[model samples]
Every structure is written in C-alpha cells, then in structure tokens.
Target: MSTINTSKRTIGVSFDESGRAHVLLWAPDAKQVELLLSGQDKTVSLTRGESGYWSVETRALQPGDLYYFELDGKKQLPDPASLSQPDDVHGASQALDINRFRWTDENWRHFPLKNYIIYEMHIGTFTPEGTFAAAEKKLDYLVDLGITAVEIMPVAQFPGGRNWGYDGVFPFCVQHSYGGAQGLQSFVNASHAKGLAVVLDVVFNHVGPEGNHLQEFGPYFTEKYHTPWGNAINFDDAWCDGVRRFFVENALMWFRDFHIDALRMDAVHAIKDFSPTHILGEIRQEVDLLIQQTGRKHYLIVELDLNDTRFINPVNKAGYGMDAQWIDEFHHALRVTSGQEKTGYYSDFNAVESLAKSYQDAYVYDGAFSEHRKKYFGMKTENPGEQFVVFSQNHDHVGNRMLGERTSQLVSFEMLKLLAGAVLVSPYLPMLFMGEEYGEKNPFQYFVSHIDPELAEAVRKGRKKEFEAFYMDGEAPDPLAEDTFERSKLQWGLIDQEPHKTLLQFYKELIAIRKMQQPLCVLNRREVSVEHNTEARVIVLRRQHKLQDVICLMNFSKEEQSVDVPVYASHWCKLLGSSDLRWNGLQDIPALVPGELALALPPESITLYSNKHE
Candidate 1:
C-alpha cells in the first residue's frame, strides 16, 4: 500500500506523505494524462479539466504496483479503476491490499453442501504451477479421494495464463495469472487446512474479451438481455442501481471478503432480471444476510440452464432462494443413459423414461413436451442438491466437446462404471471430473484465444459448423491453439496405470461406500429407492438407512439383460462390479440363492447390491 503525493481531483484513490499512488482522472478529452510506472522511475502529474476530471498525488504508489493510463500523447491505459489485472491482456493495474493476507481459515466455514463429494478443478490446468500454491499440493488427494468440496473453475481475472476460469474481468480480482489475491488466500487457506471446501466458479454471466473492465466503470452492460454470453447484465438497464450492486456486491465479496465457502453461480440462465426484488431475489436476500453475517455455513449454487424451481424454492417459499440448480436433469439423464444422443442439449434426452424421471423425479422435463425448446420446461426442480452437483465429467461437459470427448472418451468400460454407479448413489450432489477418477484418456477440447482476427475467425467458424449434428468430419480445434490449452491438462500420470488403476479402484471404492454408508450418504429422497427398466435401459437406486442398504444397479443398455425378482427383492450382497466379474465381495457375489437373487446385466454394466431387504 504505497502511492503518494497529491493535489485535488482524487475522485477515489488518494494516499500520500511518502506512500504514493493517486488518481482522480476524469478525462474530458485528454490533452495529457500520465501515470505510467512499469519500469519505475516514478511518474504522476495530471491536473487538467474544464470538466474532464484529472488530478494527482505521488509517492509513486507501491503494493505490487503496475500502473498505466498515458493517453492523449498516445494511449497506454488500464485502471479504468483496476485493482488487479496482472499481465493477462497487455498488463497494467495492480494495487491490491486485501488486508494483506494473514488468514488461517479462522475456524473455517460452509462445506456441507449436503455432504458434498465434489472435485471440479482447473487452476491453469490443476498444476505445473497453476498456482493457488499449485493446488495446495493436491490437498491429500482430495482427502484421500473422498472429497467434501473443491469446485473452482472461474477465478475472476481472466485473459491468458489460461481461460477456463470462464474469462473473468476482475470482479473484485483473484486471477492474476492464477496466483493473485494472495494466491487465492493461499488456496483457500490450504483448502481449509486439508479438510476441503472451496467452491468458487463465479462469472456473473459475461465479461471476457480480454480483461474487460466493466464497460469502463459504469453502465456495466445492457442491451435489454440477449445472452449466449453477450449483453445481458445490467440487471434492468440504466445504471441498474449500480449494476445491481455489482453482482450482489460480488456475491458478498465471496462470502464476506473471500472466506468463500460456496458460490458456483455462472450463468443463472444469463441472469437478466427485471428487478422488483429479483436479482435472484437480491441474491437470495444477500445470501440470507451473509448467512447471518458469517456465522458460518454459506452456499448459493446456480449454474442454471433455466429449468428453474425458483432455485431451490423455499425462501419462505416466495422463491428464487437458490441453494442449488445445476441438474440439467443430471445431464439430460446421463446423455440418454447410453443411446449416444449427441446434439445440442442431447436433443431432448433419449428416454429411459427420461432416465427414470431423472432418477425418480429431480426434473425430467419439468414442464414436459419439448422436442428441444418447441415449448414447455415451464419450471421445475423440487430440490436436488444435497450437493446434487452430479457429473460424470465436467469442465463444461468436457470443454464443450467438438472433439473433447471423455465420458472416458464417450462411454464404455461398463458405461464408465455405469456412470459411476449412477452419479455416486444419487440423491443429489456428487461430482468428479479430474480424469473422472482415473479413467483419463485425455481430450477436453473447445479451447479459446481470439486476439480478434474477427474473433478468431468467428471462433473457428463456430467450432466447425457447430458439430453439424455431432461430429460430421468438420475439423475444429485451433482456439488460437497453444495446443488448445495444452490439451486440457490432467493425465496425472494415469493413476498407477493399468486400466487406469482399475478405474481408480472403482473411484476409490465409490468414495468408500459413500464415506462408510450413513445410509449410503443419505442426501435423502426418503432414503432413496428407484427401480425401472425402460424396456432395457435398466436402473435401480435403493440407498436406504438404519444400518445398511446400497443397491445401485444400472445398465443404460447394449444388450445383456435379466430382471424380475419379487419386486425390489431382498437378501443380496454383491457390492460393486463393473465386471471382470469384479465385485470384490471377495470375488463378485451374484449367486445368493437363499432368498432369491440372480443378476447379470453386463453390456454396459454396473452393479452394487448388498440389500438384505433394506
């Protein structure tokens, strides 16, 4: 914190008496403007105006200094109120204080997004100095791969050093080449000192085309809503009450100034509010008044593709309370649980009764009747988020595909351990995408770079004619190629190797039986129980409570079938098998005979019994 020497006009930025850095610049058509410091020799003289604001102070500023704004004697700019932009797109503007670190988690907070099992990742491709102290040395491999939370993707200060942080533009700065804001508060204080819990993915719907700067600090944007990542934020236009308090005060400055516990946000259906209490009900009444003023446990989760159930309803039911949303009906029911329906939004998901009503009702076409936006989807989502963050792969569904494959390169290996035993025993919330627990074969494509050559040839001819109905030999990848973000990082030495360490020991024993089965991690759907067969696309859910249960069974079909067993049968044991007949019940268990239970799905296999009538 330095920057000193002054003389009126400091609209906001003043400090002198040997600690220099000052700005009151209001340029009325610059005849002069100077502040340059990079290559220091200290500079700062400005006092023009006939109503074109400009004034100064000097001590030649300090705190990580990187100033600019030369103009009218040849431009140099950046600090259109910058607090940090570190060298992303032509540098300048780096004066951060953020109470100078010194944090230690302070009895940390919020982590249980209904007993999360998340893992998202991407700090400049997770490592190789992707900083946040190189992902705090893999926080004990997500606490031994049992993860409680990690999310992270949009670090809010984007533009080279990496872009999958969804091109941020300083929303209270953090991504200064991945190690800013005291390196993400020392990577969320070393991931809450290793117990986990971080979340973050921000991007309040648009900003990025090289370190934006909120339309030069003001009208922040508004073309009366139009988003596919374009002009939608201005909350309702006209200085939108300070642009809706700059995105709910930058989501309460990441939970009371960066103590962040959860925020996910990014694309609340391109958030275009009409005010009258909306702005996601003023960010759900400012996240319930910052969760009772940081008394702890925070969360806001949104990602929404607009199937909105007023985002987890129940804010005394008036709605938009939001504590969760990303259910895309579990990726349109795991991309049609196997028929390979690859098209924009999986062309209304190929039915297994719409993946058994998106696993027994989470949203299987809430408002129904849609052949892809012809009509319905009038809203639905009764709950889904006991950490309901489901995913068989994420990084925007494998970097928006177009050759980014991976559901272990598009299914198989027993439907990728039957979509990880149906999103880790579904009841909501379960994610893992860093090499989908070691099935890593690579490819997360659709990279971006655009130093505008007509926006990089209109994003490479819109990613080669938008997949002309899924992979039509079009040739894509060249998002200003740095080998397309160095081929989406994360081949972490292929976890122990063989069949990728047997799908990383069946995803570390399905996260150790959902962390030693509290009724198999009860995110509760009345103890979860589902059973169906859409003719062949099998399904089973079970879960249960009071000591034991589990079930799981899934097929998503290719052929091998067999069903019918005294309805939801009983006396079972098997316990995990994606086949090599590998159910480690000390050698796969489907021969029970005592109370009748004989199974074999095989085709795209997945099994996990142990019921005993639950």
Candidate 2:
C-alpha cells in the first residue's frame, strides 16, 4: 500500500475531463478493497492511501455502469455517495453523467424572498403517474396559480416505491421510482424554463432504518445523541469531519449539480450537534460561497420546532444566519380557529387571540410558558424579520393526522377562504400545499412501502398508538397498505367541478389581489397591525405603507356580526370578499361607506378593503 493525497476525490466515483471514472472509497477498517464489475467475475484492486482512503482509476468505468465495493474480499455494498440507484435501495449503484443533460436555463435569474410564493408538492402524489416526468406537465398550472417557487418534498432514495421521503437512506440518489436522476434534471430544467425556482427538501438528522450502508463505510452515526429516527448523525465526535463534509457536500450538489435554487432542510431541531460551529451555520457559509462563485442566488431554509430566532439571526449577532424557517404558529392558530380537532397542540392556542398574535408577531409562544410542554419554550422576537415561512397546510400538518384529512374536509369553504387570505396577504413568505388552491378533496395520508415484514407490522402498530391522543373517530389506516398510498394521490380533475372551480377561482383572485396591491405585498413589520373583537369573533388586520393602506376584516363566527373600525377612513373600496355572491356565497356584500364605525360582516367571511384616502 502506498500513501496518497487525502484531499483528492476519495468518495464516490468522479469523472475526469476525458470521461474516465475515478472510483474511491473510505474504508480504514478494511485491509483489502475490490471493485466488483457488473456481469463479470473480474475484480479490480484499489490502493489504500492516507486517511484510509482507497483509490483506483479506469477507462472501463462509464456513466450508467453498475458496480459495488467488496470490503476485505467479502461483504459487497453500494457506494455511500452513489449519484444514481436504478434499482431499489437494496440493489447496486449506477453511475450517472450529470453533464450529459443539456440545460437551457442559463439566463434564468433567481428571485429573492420578497418575490416568493412557495408551493409545496410531493412528486409521487402530484400527478397520476407519480413520476418527475408526470410532474413536469403541471409546471404551467403552478405558474398560472401564482407560484414563483416549488418546494418539493424529499426525493432521496428510500426502501420501496412509496414513502413520505423522510425515511430515506441514500442522501445522494434521487428516488428511482420518481424517474431517477435524469428525470429530476429534466424536471428542474422544465421549471426554470417556466420561470419557477426549485426548492428541495433534504433530511440530515438520521438515515432510514432499511438499507443504510453508510455505517459500513465510516462512523456516520453516534450514540452520543439520539433522534426520533434512531442514533443521531455524527457531526462533532472523533473523525466526524468526514460526516459533516458528506452532508455539506450533498447540499452543495443540489445547487451546483442539480441546479436547485434553494434547500428546505427538514427537522433541524432533531440534528443535535453541540460543536462550536453548528452544522447549519457551516452549510449556510458554504452555500454563501457558492452563491458568489456561481453568481446565482441561493437560499437555505430550515424546519425547526424550537421557534428560536437564532436560526435566522445573523451570525455576527450570535445566530445561525439561516435565510428563513417554517413557523407553525400561524398554522396551528388557524387550524384551531377554523374548527379542526383541538385536543393536542391545539390546546395551547385560543384561536382568535392566538391568530392575532401570529399576525402581530411570528411566534405566539415566544418566551412564554407552555401548558402543553410544561416548560418555557421559544425565544422572544419582535418582528417576523421576513424570514418566517407561513402556510395554512403542508405535508406534515395534513398527513400526520389520524385520518389524513385535509383542511377542506375539516372546515367549511368559507373558513378555507379566510385562512387563505390570512396566509397569502401576510408579511412573511407564503406557501401552499399541493391541490390546496383547488380545494382537492383527496386526503394526503401517511404511507410507506417497507420490505421487512416485521418492521412493517411494527410501523402499523406505532401509527395506531400515535393517533390515540387525538381521539379520532375511525380506525387508523395501515401505513404499509398499498391502498393507503393510492388513496392519498391528488384528484387533478376536481378543479373542473362546481364548488372546487369556484374555490379555485377565489384563490386565484386572492393571489392576484396580493400581487396587484402594493400595500399588501410590503413585508415591513412596522407597517402591519392586528386588532380583534373577542366577543364578536371578528379580526381586523391593518397594513400601511406610506400613502397606501389596506385592511383585512375576518368574521369567524357562524352568525353575522357587526365589527367596529377604530381607524377612520375617508374613502374605502372593496377589493375582495370571500362571502361575495361571485364566489358561490349566498349573500351579496356592498362596499363600506366612509366614516362608518360599524361594518357588517357575513358569517365566516373575509373582506379586504383598500383605503386610498386614508
């Protein structure tokens, strides 16, 4: 064995200028490394270099070549950094040439946070075919719906054909069932051509339980800290530098190789790293450097439960300096207020007051004691910082329920319109779940396809116990059932129906209003205020920007209520009303007269008024 440079490409197969593949593996514990070629008995020996890295170069290897690594002359496994897995997670790794695909998005410019209206989608359920190619057909529909960016759920390779994607084992490989790497590249290219940015969701907390081969390659996990999935990923212990580099490189690969504009990190709170510099901070710093080198805008968003401002606070201010984070306070408050089951986390929210606080501040329980957790939670913050991503419904919020019921099933159409107004017109970045704009009746259920029979049985039992607290009506659906996954697929034809079409039109109108009205689009926290009447169950949100002012009045009660306006207006014009007869409402609402303190609000209706003479 000869000592070689450790800084060289010592992970997955990398291609040189001549198109020859350079294969490398990190196996300090193995004394012998052999590359097993597909459909051949011959094996190539790899030389061990410094830092236990084994390296070998050959022209015989090319894109789409299937191969595996044999450790100590036995125990063959897929490459830890495999870029494409044509077979399932248990099959061999296939080399993919990312440069082969020609891209026409070189002139596409990345937009900033102020221009973002994110639409979250799961590719498997977004269309009937459940493939990236199938999803490419919907790009025009999303663009027409006012979505500037599409936040895709995790596409990392998992065990079988169906999964929610959080339980992925191969962080580098795109799911083979979703058209593999080539399909993903085509999808991204199609999106950019249609003027839509792609935001990919990635998980670094813990690897999936099935087909996780990283442990055999290196110490990628540790018992020092435990996560809900299993042992936490090693990020701060001995030889943890490789572990950190692996994940950070994965994020960069999405931006540099896959042409992803942003990454929405899943469950950052579960990533327990007590190092001097957190992994999130390191990822952000590396992404920043990539932005400068490529001259393209990139963003790092996180899904955190801590509600800590440090996630978005600048690093100079002793924070992680993330671009944005998904805040669930607004969702929870809206869910509870709109008459969803309020037994679990909903107990912390009192609806009207909590919604008011959510509009005024990003977090309702910032530094406040929680009865649910029985301890002080969250950091205090004054403004939303335009770094909070607000949504009425998403994958977790809908699929995690006992029955996987959507907000449309849980609340009336009027309440749904009200919730849409609250999220879309807010100062923070707004996101919509798949089919939400059309009021799709199909539920987004929790489904999985695990190969292990024993593990599959255990998953079914665990799901039943988890939803017991909610006291749901029907029996919980078996997660391993194929019918469960099929039922969760979005019904695309629903948009042509009567009520669904009307609701879809209403959503389009609301988005148009948000974009056309300058006061509604301004993200300044100082210009926004919320006032509500507890007894009448009506709330008024005021937004003022220089000479322009807008007010959104919402009635949560079942019966009509008279709301008082404290701020006098010289002239007011009705921009939109959810209960208007145009939107399938029974009553016709008239514009408010000037100097009128008492305004009649229809039951469960939301009305927006623009005061030009304020």
Candidate 3:
C-alpha cells in the first residue's frame, strides 16, 4: 500500500479552478494508459503518477464529450467513474457537468427517518414511458397517497433498456433507459418540490455480469470470498483501499451531486470486509461529515439478511452506524400468518406470535435457533421502532416468486386491507411497493436484457433452479423475454375499476390514519404492547405516545372470531375498520364500542380503535 492524496478527487474526472478537465484513472498494473475522445482521431497519453494513478489536464475535451481509456494501447474501456453513459454501459462515457443542472430544491430539507412512509418503485415499470420524466408527473399522486419518501430502484447503468436494476455495473452512471443523468436530477428536484424525499437503492455487493469493466481497471473483485452472483467485491483485501474509495465516492456522489436524500444499500450481508474500519462504518463517518458541511440531513439504510444490530448501532458503540435497515422478518411473519406456504425461509415462521414478536421486539429470531439455516441466528437489538422499515411486499418478495404474484393476487380483498393495516399501524416505519395500494393484478416478474446470448440463457436456467426448493410445479417465467418485462408494467387504468378504486381509497385512508394518529405516527417500541391468541389467530397491539393510545386488532383466521379486550378507558372509538362498507367490505361491524369485554372481528380483517379519554 502507498500513501495517496485524500484532499482532491483523484478517481474520476473533475474540473479545476482553471476550468480545465482533470482526468484520473487507477490502473496500477497497466504500464500505459491513453485517453481517447469520441470525435478526435488522436489519443492523448496520460502521465502515470504515484500509487498507480494516471492523470492529465486537458481543455480540448469539454462537458458532454464522450471519452474512453485505452489501457496499454490494447483495450479501450469507459471510465469506471463515468457520470453519464448515454449510449448504455458498453458504449462511450459521456462527460457530464453535474453542476450544470440548476436545482430548485435549495430550501428543501429532509425530515426525520421515523416520519418516512416510503413507496418503493422501479423506474421502468413505474409508468408507461418508463423514464424519470414520466415518473415526475406522478409526484402529486404519491403526495395524495400520503407518501413522504420515494425509494427508487438502482439506476446504475446495466447492459440494456429493461432490468430490475440490481444488475447495474456502472455505479456512478444513471440508467440510460431511465432518461440518464439529467433526467434523475429533474426527478429529484420535482420530488423535493412535492415534499417527497428520494431514497436511491444502490448495489454494493456485486456488479452485473455484462459490461462490467471494474476488474479491467484494478483488483475490484476478490477470490477469497464468493457471493451468490459471483466473486465478492474486493474489500479489506490486498488492493482494497482503491476499491473502498470507489464505492464511498459513489455514495457521496448521489448525495452531493444528485441531491439524493438517502441510499438504500442492497444486500450488505454479501459485502465481505474483515478490516479494522468496516466499509459501512467508513461510509457513515463520511456521510456525517457531509451532513455537517451541507447543513442537510442524509441517511444510509441497508438491506441486510443478517439480524445484526451492529449495522444500525451508532459508531460510538463500535457499530457501523447505519441509520436504518429493512426488516424482512416482519414481512415473512406477516405472510406466513396470512397463509403463505411454509417453504424456504417461511418455514422459520409459523404462528401469529411471530408477527407479535416482531412488533414487540424488532427481530423475531434474536439469538434463537433457526430451522431455516438449522442453526442459532441473529442478535437482539434494543433499537427504536423507526430503525426498522417494514413492508408487506417489496421488489424481492414479489419479483423473486416463480409467478411474481403480489400479495394482492395471492390473498383476498379483505386480507389485503388487513395486511396494509398490519404494516401501517405498527410501530416500525412502513413502506409500500408500487401499484400495491390499488391492488394492481399484474405480476412484477423479474426481467433483464443482458445482450449476450450465453448470459441470457444462463439467467433463464438460474431462475428455474431458484424455485426448486419451493416445489413450484410450473416453469418459472423467462427472465430474458421481452414480454416478461412488458407483463410487469403497472396498469394505471386499473385504478379506475371496481375493486381497484375501493382499495386505493382504503389505502389513502389507512395512510392518513398512520400520519395523523399520534400513537401510530410516533415510532416508539417501548410504548407498545402486543397480545395475541394462537387458536383464534388474532393479535391485538396497543401503541402509546404521551397520552395518546391506539389499539389494532387483527384477525388472521378465515372465519369471524371474538377476542376479549382489556378496557383501559370508558370506551374504544373505531378509527377505521377493514369490514366497513366504504372499503367494499360488509359494514356489519360497529362504529363504536362501549367497554365491551369481547369484540367480534370479521374474517381476515383489521380494526383500529383509539381509547376515549373520558
């Protein structure tokens, strides 16, 4: 390892005070490196400096100019830190002036993480146009649904037009099919204007197979560990310093340049690092510094499989200091209780008690023996409720299915409303997948365009193999087919239909209740209590904030049941009921209860009641 300058940005192209473009490339193994501009017939040889860094200051190539690096005058590749890939990942890298985009969100400020009601969306399937510009037109729709934040799937450049976005190889470049760099800037600006925070999902575990030129530049992957995708990203290895810088700078680029409110780091359990300073910890430290400098708030949320508190724990406690993480246990337990097949990881959870445990304790498997892995798994976390983002259906939960059937398609209408209540009324932060509010019937199947025939066939075979454990009888949908991606597109026209219209209104009311109700809005696990019955398949949760108290009663059984209620007040006022006729359910349930010992609950329904102070 050699000492390198940390003050200046040396891994990418930057414009200096003299308005000259300074190009930097880290190719320690290559003996020669040359810069090739798109239109110019001549190639400029870069001067190699210390620590295998090559650089050149040029005024000939201006912003928006396409350029490539010719290594050893043999292989010409796009810049690893390309800001714009206008011609897809395999083509030339466009020089983007990030400062050129005039933003109207100067006064916009991010709210607390606890207040976030996230709506996760994939840009391509979010609208018919499948671009950032098209998605911007739906900001008011999100606001009307009471969403405080929008978490977009990975925008990093992949091989072709359509993808779920996890296959992105170019970490810095926005997806060309999604209207590129300028498109994202405008979307973020529009999101901020609509008072919606933009949370960008970023993949740090593995890059996509095709058009991945990181290995060509340096030792970006390690042979020591292997991920499900392929070789794990080289972190805490021989030449890990440069690899660490590459990703850390990528995270900062989203915040500083694109004005992204937060980053949802994808599958962090695959990030193999055994260093003294963990990669996540380092990213958090740098983000904190950026927050202080910009006087704006930013968050780092992780999609982790391991139930480890160290990721969300503060750095002062020798933890990674991630602000929040997605809690899949909640979703698993909720689904299992909703009659999901006890296959794969779902076998680990069985009863309504698991859902109750998730509500009380953040992790249900906190140091418990796991039947899934056949070993003790997870650590207990005394973290606040807001530290966990709970969702009934996300991209992975839906798209990974053999048929990509959403909860809406699998469960009945009443059960859908119950699931919504179970998530929204909980103490944890709530998130909803795109088109889930209106019960869109279209499946969100996994789709990709790899451009390589061999790679495409491999993906098709791999998708079928993944469903082997579930004992799914039919053939899995072809991931490489164009119609697969087309079928996944959300049908906006469905919102105006019979059941869809009612479900959408129900979601609006539910979200409004979550926002306006004091006990529901305030995320405090300590102020919550859970009670359930295994036989009746009923769970009652009580959440309190100061003097406010709200109770959520959920019936997971197929038939109507009655459960004893502990009266803490004179009576319990009905806030919302899934059985209400307004939501297309039978209105047989009462609006108010007068200190009743037992209350009747409709089949597969959830009812909310706030205690009367009198």
Candidate 4:
C-alpha cells in the first residue's frame, strides 16, 4: 500500500517550503486543463498525473492572485477547491495564504462538551452592520450572558449579499459580504481572546444550485441518490475517491488552517454514502488524527433528522463516531408542550409525556411508532447526556414558519420563561438562538439575493409552497424583497426596554444557576429523573449529583395548579421563581418550602428548588 503524502496537500492550491504555489485538480475525463491568471494574460498547461489528476508548480502565481482553470481550452471555471472568492461565487477565485494571518489563540483551550452553553447567531442578522467585525464587538456581551461557545451559521460563499447560507456554492470560501477570509479569522481570534469557543456550521450534503461549477470539472455528483436540494454528491459511485478527498480535506482545512474549535455539520441526513467506510467516519478518523497532532480538542456536531444513534456511537460499534448531534425530538416535544399547533411533524409528539421521555431518554421516539412519519422510528441507545444538544428555537424552527414568528411573538412572557427553564435545566447541552434570551420580537424570515432572476423566482415559489400546509390566508413574504431581509435583523435596543429587560435578566440568572449549581451542571443521564402529570399539565424534573439535588417544577397550564413534591428531603430552598415580581410576574412565591409539601404553581411559570442551604 502507498503511504499518504504528508509534504503537500493533495488538492487545492498550497505553498511549499519555497514560495512557489502548487496547484492540483481532479479532472479524470478532460483531455487538457489550463490555468488562467486574471489580469496577467498568462495561461499554463498542467501535466496529467496518476488517477487522472492534473498538477502544476509555478513561480508566476503569488498569494492574492486571482485565477481560473480553463478546461480543454474551451470553458473557464473557478478552482473547485477555491480558498477565497472575493467577487462572489460567479467571479474569479483569489489565492489566499491562510497562514499569513497571525493567530493570537495559541493559549486558548476548548471547553468540555458538557459545559457548553451554545449561542447560535447568523451573521447577516446578528447586528446592523452584519459583518464579522461588527459581530466581534459583541463578544463581551456574550461572555457576560454566560455563553461558552458561539455557533455561526455557514459563511461559505453564495450568489449574493443576503442569504440564509444553505445556498452556499463555494464550500471553502467565506462569504464576501461577511468580510471574507480575513474577517472570519479576526472574529474567531477575538472570540477566543474573550474565552469563547467558536463552532462553524458547514454544509456538506449538497452544493447550492446557483454558481455551482463542480460538475464541469469531473464526476463530482451522482444520480444514484436524490436530495431535497439537488442530486447527491458522488460519494459511493465510481471515481469517488477524489470526491471524498475533496470534502475530507475541507473539514481538515477548518481545523488545521482556520483554527476552528468545532464544526456544526448542517443536515447530515441528506448526505448519502454506501461505501464500506462512511464519509462521516472518514472525516472523524482524520479529525482524530489532527487532534492527536495538535494536542488541541475539536468537535464534530451534526444536525440530523434521523433518530438513529449509530452516528454518535463509537466506530468499533459499527457507527460513524460523531462527537454529538442536535436532538430535534426534544425541541418538537418541548414545542408541543408549549402549545404549538400539532401539524406536520409536530403531530407525533404528546404534550408533557413526550418532553418527559426526552429528558430521561435522549430520544422521544426511540423504537416507537411515529404518526407523522407513518412508521416505527429510531433506535434505542445509552449514550451520555452530553452527546445531545437541545434548543427551544433555531434558524429552521423560527425561519421556516409562514410569517416567521419568533417564540416571543407566538407565546406569552411567562410561557417563554417556562420554555427557557425547560431547556437550561435538562441534562443535555443547551443552545440559544440569537436574541432568544431577551425575547426579541423581530422575525427571522428566510431571505436571499440570488443573481439569476429565474433562480430567485424559484426560491420565492419554493418558500411559499413549503408553508402552504401550515397557513392558507395570507401570501408568504417575498424572499427576494430587500425589506424581508431588513425585517429579520435583530433589534439590539430592545434589550433595554420593558419585558425584554426582565426577560434578559431572567436568562442571565438561569444560565448562572446552571453553571454554578452542581446538579444542573453535571451531564449524567443516570442521575436524572422526570415525572409529569397529564391532568394538571405539570412536569417535575429531579437532578442529583453526589449530595447536591435540584428540582425544576414547570406548569404548562393556563390556570394555577397545586403540585406535590415527591422528594424526601426535609428542606427545599427556592432558587428561582418565574412568577415572582422581579421577573415581572403577577404573584410572589415562597422562598422556603418542605420537601413533600403541595405547592401552588403560578400559571405558565417554572420554579426551581434546591436542597443546598444558603
């Protein structure tokens, strides 16, 4: 067997020991490939190497030079492994020396997965400027809010300025509108300096339709499987080794070149692979190797709709060996309990019992029948609590709606507190969408700026068709309209206002308690127990670690209900009450209580009690 080459990258443009640039392209069917340097009026022929690969080393090309690959001297296209696309996805690719930027995070260490309090933010809507530099200015605020990691939406270069980022075509290039490669590096550096880890969302399932030039190069896509976006990537068919290497190297680029702490893989279920070694497993194997070489911790968290635990299981157990995954069942159950309409996939979950099941078991539908799916779904697993990430509101949950109403607009203030409490108190890792902590009322509507008029119309029609089942009265907002994008921007000023101020304080307190309290901080599934009452619409969750114990009592009903404490402790001290006047609640709850006493819980509120004596 041939040993792997460690001197230079097998794909993309890389600089060797000398200053000369080495270029490699995988075009098996093409007879001749030429490199076109923009503004230099120079073209160099590439030598065809083994496995139909093309390679060339030249001193004429320098860092920051813009170039394109001319296939067979007939059609010109950007490099498939482009490091930067300064003029958007359709234009020329800019050569970038990622090592040129000096990093200041050498001493920074990643936080444990169990201790992660993730804050999900979209660059275009995070602030008024919507650039990486503008977002970096708010790092201190995130630190003050007790966030351990900041999860950014995809920065891959797309067609235009405004997009949700799933439409990205250049997987290796940062969005030019978001300040490009240098902007992201500065943002990550600042985040680490503030003691916050960075998690980048990446799309590997399918490339965006507009500005996609991979098929022009080689068999980069296959018709063997179909995805919601387009044809599946060529991962299992013939000539798949080069395709697999392209993506596997992309993952390594983020960790090795960009110094990213974690990658939140977007929609792994859409990725189809039938090879004996799955693509995810290959990426995991390479990431593990990188971790060993650097002595720095990194994570691969996937967004999967499937409830199968094989993705998170160890490789020895015939699994993909992913570090963690987002639990949509927990969000679905929690949403149903919060009075969301039971339509579409929401029809499968029950109110309080499903939420309880998610708390005890990581999956609510483990080996159970799903009415929405019309089949028995999920496999049971005994994975640790930290392996699952749970959230109340994310980009999909909020942006996919017809009117794009946030939880704050759809629910009451008291119920918001109750929902926030439910997520923070759970055994799994907690995630918060941007402005969710302060209950921002602005909608996170889906928007895009596709350059092609036909493609833009198609996206507008797709958005309308998607929400047809949930809404029928009004027409869905036009995704191409500029105001639609403007409407989605977060109103940072709202944090200083009435209910928003109180809600922000409430979130800070909840996060502080979660970090400081032992029972709440520990991610042990065995030490957690949940009990719910269907008639009263109440859920009582108990978490104990060693001598410390904490109980979270939630009232989902609109009317006040009396609940009996099942614990045997003699004294229980009140830690927080959402119904208290400080949080703008109507009533004042007790500060002290007996363990087995029946207590009156305010309508749509959550109260926390602990055995630790103050």
TM-score, one value per model: 0.35, 0.96, 0.97, 0.98
Off by more than 4 A, model 3 = 1-10, 468-473
Candidate order by TM-score, decreasing, is 4, 3, 2, 1
lDDT by residue (234-313, candidate 4, tens digit) is 99999998898888888888887778899999999999999989999998888887787788889999999999989999
- Report the Cα lDDT for candidate 2: 0.86
- Per-structure clash totals for the candidates: 21, 0, 0, 0
lDDT of 1 by residue, 296-363 (tens): 77788887776667666866887777777677667766766776665666777765667666766777
Better of 1 and 2 by lDDT: 2
Model 4 spans with C-alpha error above 4 angstroms:
1-10, 468-473
Best by TM-score: 4
Candidate 4 — what's its lDDT? 0.91
Better of 2 and 4 by TM-score: 4
lDDT (0-100) at residue 245 of candidate 4? 84
Q: Pick the candidate with the highest lDDT.
A: 4
Q: Weakest 10 consecutive residues, lDDT, candidate 1?
A: 1-10
Off by over 4 Å in 1: 1-75, 80-114, 117-152, 155-198, 202-253, 262-391, 400-417, 426-429, 432-449, 452-472, 477-517, 522-546, 554-596, 605-614
